[model samples]
Target chain A: MLEAREPMSAEAAEVSRPSRRGTLYRGDPGMWSWVAHRITGVLTFFFLFAHVLDTALVRVSPQAYNEIIETYKTPLVNLMEVGLVGAVLYHALNGVRVMLVDFWAKGPRYQKQMLWGILVVWLLVMVPGAYFMLVRTVTEMFGGS
Target chain B: MTLALDKPRTPRRPAARRNNWELASWVFMRVSGVALLVLVLGHLLIMNILDGGVHRINWGFVAGRWSSPFWQFWDLAMLWLAEIHGGNGLRTIINDYARKDATRFWLKVLLYVSMVLILALGTFVIFTFDPNFDA
Candidate 1:
């Protein structure tokens, strides 16, 4: 029997349901971009919450907060920090593009150009960001106890 | 674009009145996703790794980084990316669920309003943040 092509109402009831049609990322820029934005944004939201809570730990007691901060000083911890900042950065930049779409700044012909524009902007910011972050790490290593 | 001229006829409303919002949204998600992978991953590697760790991050850290045009650009990139991603996702949901023209229109207006305000506020925060604020 041939499988039903259209998603059925019952299928909607199931959680974590993915259609047989290959993932939408196979499509064009907007589909995957939208998905990435969503996944990253959700992740960012939770991470932001955690960041706030982690910082707030200091309010309870300096010793408690310092313990968490000390652990975050490791290489592995630094690695995660990169991921965190990256998530925040990408999500933020892409968010602006999405907002522009509302106003009709990009059309079919301009779509590719807009994508490239976003890339250039990302690079412009990232290079300096990386430099400063590195400098901070280096300084901390040599300057502090 | 040619297909756009060929209208989907419905007794209720003319196709001309209906814009190609859905198709544009579909395209946006994909493009944004690819960018996210690259930009976000790169951001992570640089901030967390590359040198020391979190203890290295402090007030001077923010000042030292932001003072440069480069990190300012980086913060700008991250800020724009997340905002667009989130706003587009919300747009998709609005179009999918909202039915009545008035409802959809107003909701979208509200969405855009909040979106702009947040974008402005966040951008200001990134650029104006002072690492040297005296406690």
Candidate 2:
């Protein structure tokens, strides 16, 4: 690579190199959490559009509605349901954190702590939630009562 | 001892010229966010975690639920709130990322179009849904 770049002087290459320091503002927890919020928000919105379309099938015929909805019951879709719920849950929890940060007197001071708090709460809810959500899929995969 | 500054670096907009629409949108996001936290999480629990989960969802189940006025209202409220909330969120995203004026304008146009389409379609379906429709 160094021999291949013999055309350009070393100083020119050095000057052209992008600065690595503070490129992403150091990406603290607050920034990362916000990014997650935006990503989940967009995904959920698109899913919402699709969901509304799927639900609209109810008006066409019972068979049509039932047939489309069946796609949701498959194993892959069930796991995706878990992921969807997880995304929504994170957004909802983080949203509350955001509100607290905006409205509460000491919100900014405690924002980082609240981020961790929400994460804990997310785990608390999701563990059992995943189990319950995947019960049908699990039952079908391995014979169960 | 503090050194006094002659003027602020970035002057604030005059009260008259300042727009409240952005503020209103900000407030709406927080308020609607709280409501949706309850409405949507409860919806997930009931629809995805309770009893048979998504397996229980079917035409008959929908018909049975819509047969009640309470659920009808619940669903209608959810549909409207969620669509608007999501639309507003997308609006913010578009404003943030779309650099060019034309790009931003057209993106918002697309957003608004789909928002209207989904709202209209969802509302029509809910209102006109007939449980007794023979297959």
Candidate 3:
């Protein structure tokens, strides 16, 4: 603990560089949704940007776009597809939780309980989805008729 | 102000603000994200790689793709889900970063407007796509 404290002291000075007063909402557990929504939104947006660029290449030259699309036909692309959709789904679902907070459904008192609910549902849905993406399709694709 | 679930936790005050919205938004992101996982990944596999690849995709392909009610519903679901999920995610960002209440409100108005427009347009395209316009 002492060693951990020693290295962090220098970083702590940087961390505490304060923003304007009244601007900063001292965070609670629920507030993390607001933060995560931004992070995952931005991450998903980045992938979307790449997708648009790839697809828009069709507009520039259909061949070029098709060529790119052809490359995405690979197993690597399947994994990427899974990742991209996973990112979008997680961001969207957690974002809904954040919206519920806005409407005042789950508060600080129930934050922990609601967070667990969120996790449970996320895994439940995503696991099946992952199977659909990674296992079922690949099995069908590669396994000979 | 406090709201009670099992029992009334807090007394109703005349002008109490609200509880945390941030949490619900977080939940939305996760839930919709899981749905998208299925919709989007299945879409990619069926469309891009399952058959002989992009060469197999053409006008008849487009018509054939949408022929399935399953794919149509899947696309429709993905379109609206992504839009709402993305829109709500943006709303969270706005609440966090937007400085003024007026600014936040107006920005969200714009976001929601765009969301509705895009959602409508995308759905319409899916439902009424003309695969044989030049045929």
Q: Highest TM-score: give the candidate number.
A: 2
Question: What does DockQ give for each predicted structure?
Answer: 0.08, 0.36, 0.08
Q: Which regions of candidate 1 are displaced past 4 Å?
A: A1-41, A45-145, B1-10, B17-35, B97-114, B130-135
- Candidate 1's residue-wise lDDT over A54-117, tens digit each? 5444334545556777667665665565566665666666655654544453333354456568
Q: Compute the lDDT for candidate 3.
A: 0.60
- Top candidate by lDDT: 2
Once fitted onto the true fold, the runs of candidate 2 whose alpha carbons sit more than 4 angstroms away are: A1-24, A143-145, B1-19
The 10-residue segment with the lowest total lDDT in model 1 chain A: A1-10
Please provide, for model 1 over B12-129, each residue's C-alpha lDDT reduced to its tens digit, 9 standing for 90 to 100: 5543546666566556655665576666566565545455435455445556777788877876775566567656666666666789989989988986776676566656656666
Candidate 3 lDDT for residue A65: 43
Provide the TM-score of the second chain in candidate 3.
0.70
Clash totals for all candidate models? 44, 0, 41
Ranked by TM-score, the better of candidates 2 and 3 is 2
- lDDT per residue for candidate 3 within B1-135, as digits (tens), equals 255554345566455438656556656666676687678656755653455443365445555666788777987898777777777766766776899999999999988877776676666666766544442
Interface RMSD of each: 9.2, 9.1, 9.0
- lDDT, candidate 3, A1-145, per-residue tens: 0000011223333444356455765654444654554676767754643553454343344455456776665677767766665665565555445444444643434544666688788788778766765664477678846
Model 2 per-residue lDDT tens digits across residues A7-112 = 2223323543357564654545776788899899999999999999999999998999999999999999999999999999999998888887776877766777
lDDT of 2: 0.85
